[model samples]
Target chain A: MSVSTVRPDVYAQVQHFYARQMQALDAGRFADYANTFTEDGTFQHSPGAQPAVGRAGIVAELERFHERFADDPVQRRHWFNHVALEPLPDGSLSSTVYALIVTVRPGGTPKIGPSCVVHDVLEITEEGVLTRSRLVTHDQEAA
Target chain B: MSVSTVRPDVYAQVQHFYARQMQALDAGRFADYANTFTEDGTFQHSPGAQPAVGRAGIVAELERFHERFADDPVQRRHWFNHVALEPLPDGSLSSTVYALIVTVRPGGTPKIGPSCVVHDVLEITEEGVLTRSRLVTHDQEAA
Candidate 1:
């Protein structure tokens, strides 16, 4: 058997941090998920040209999600992929992950929504929080 | 207790495949890593204007990685960020994945090398292979 020795201990923790973000969002716990980042961290949909900067921007942008789905279903699932991990010189682990996040519209078929492929640079902070610089590439434009 | 509930399965699978490719390269398995894509996959590095087309083109470029590295100690990690996964009506996943790739040279320093952030699109085949389109994106040239 080709055992997948993905070093779950060190890298697994990194993935778990990411998993939390997805879980919170799926559970309609956006506030909890948004707080996962550091105060000075960034979340940019597009990297170089233009990006929504900082925590406030991130939080505000995330708000649109809930607002858009204010009357939508509370249950959903977010799947991520292309997760890559690397150990930094500071003895911390960083990773990049992508996932297909599906929000099941209540009382309707589970329609495939917007897909995102992200570039994330994160380190496990002293307090164990993940501090990251994120750049999101949008494959599907807003409908 | 929060979990990520992203949309689309192919997006995650594509990301998984990309991550696996990097891992294989770190293990000194370049050929194996390169073979993960279709025979006509295109690879665009730089700021994008032009892409290296065809599997042969992509392979020729990536082979340089093998020639440059002596062993597995050389680690190059590609971190991805804000991913947008789009589910096509045809059932395939159309994705825009933004990546921040940090490369580590094998020398004792082992600190960090320069990084490149790229936006790429992938077409996942019915047979489970991931392929890049020969066409380039309009914004790929900007940054």
Candidate 2:
């Protein structure tokens, strides 16, 4: 019988972290979302693009993203599903999740944005919070 | 310092399997795609749907799917990326991949279909072929 080596609690913590992170982003709480990462966390929008490193950098990038939809009537909802987390050798965990971004506008049908996969390297901070190190791998060229 | 427990060869194999499977589907080789599965393998299109069990069932389902675009000037390309594989204690390997399906129609803008995640349970057969057991876990209801 094949059984998962990861503890059930680890899965629970990872899931909850993702849920809260998405909520913070959808609520335009850039600071809260950035707090989910480590001090030197990184968010790579695509494979060849420059990653936004550190909490400050992440917040800056997300703030700019939120600014795009601020004046417009468009709302973006990020749906992350089918998350799989595995414990790595050094105690940090690796996770993969598929993100579906839905764009909603007044008098317009909801449109789905680019579907991409995010592979995350997560570590538990001293506060026992799950913090991301690297995330999001896409096919786009570097900015 | 962190190192992956999954070997380099394992990643190579998983990547090759997805590449071949997608090629087979795109080339309309339903049989070839079906043959990638075990005799009693299953394909689940969504979370709560009846899976197409066995090779014959897989072939039949895929053939019907192919027929939908046969006469139309539509092309479907399945891109599987961000693949993560973990070795199970029972010798089987578990993998998660994000799939982006692009649909292109004659004289129409190419559209992206549902972006979803697929968690596959793969086992190597006696003949050293990677065979999948369960595949495709999406948020949408089963068709």
Candidate 3:
């Protein structure tokens, strides 16, 4: 395993990338959120789960998510913390972050949905940094 | 109103600094947490709240916090996101982060406390980055 420090600029780039990506998703901009990933990017909900491959597949999954919550008036916000980035030997970046999903309904208290850890492989391109793959694992499942 | 992009390394530095500082506090290492600030640093909970001045004063306030939660068996975690940093004319750094405080008791669901924004003036010291001043404002208060 190669362990190298990630440069500051790279860290900032990844941070900004997620900040923009999550904001787009939370705001219901499915296409914009999917664009943050590579055309062939994959999103796995958990280990052994069928992955959403490619931009269209990713957008389909997000649309399903929208429909699933269509009846709910609650707002959901994704907060990422403890973002640790590692420079891979292939010139990509391996990033791990704690993902907190907070949901709030009108005039109701905010609730944390579940504790999760997101692992991402990011590649830099002429367009900026984009996630090549992402896998999210619930804390309970990890235990 | 200079809006310069923060360098990647500087962004990484600030992220690691907060990660370490928040972990120390959540772990109940009050003194270690207070040491992340300068000797004469100030911590204001809100706009009109009296600030805790100096390391000793900070520790004293933390001790009060410890006592307040002594009877509770809940674990508290501080998650920070959307960290925006700016280089100041005086060579300091201005940092603003959305702070989420999550609390979970054994076998209970996790809940988010109040939403907050923390603003800090950071100075690069020989020992790395240290907070010179910190002010936290609740989201409701801002509205």
How far residue B101's Cα lies from its native spot in candidate 1, in Å, is 23
Candidate 1 lDDT tens digits, B1-143: 33433343544445555676655654456556556555666666554346666666666777764576644445444445555565556654455655543444333222322333444445555445365552323333344
Model 3 residue A5 CA deviation in Å: 3.0
DockQ of 3: 0.18
lDDT by residue (tens digit), candidate 3, B37-98: 88999999788889999999999988876797788776677888888998888999999999
Model 1 residue A37 lDDT score: 69
lDDT of candidate model 2 versus the reference: 0.70
**Alpha-carbon RMSD of each model:** 15.6, 10.8, 6.2
lDDT of 3 by residue, A7-110 (tens): 66777777789999999988989889889989899999788789999999999988886897798897889988877676789999888777878889999998
DockQ of all models, two decimals each: 0.08, 0.07, 0.18
Best by lDDT: 3
Best by DockQ: 3
Docking class of 3: incorrect
TM-score order, best first, reads: 3, 2, 1
What DockQ would you assign to candidate 1?
0.08
What lDDT does model 3 reach? 0.82
lDDT (Cα atoms) of all candidates against the true structure: 0.56, 0.70, 0.82
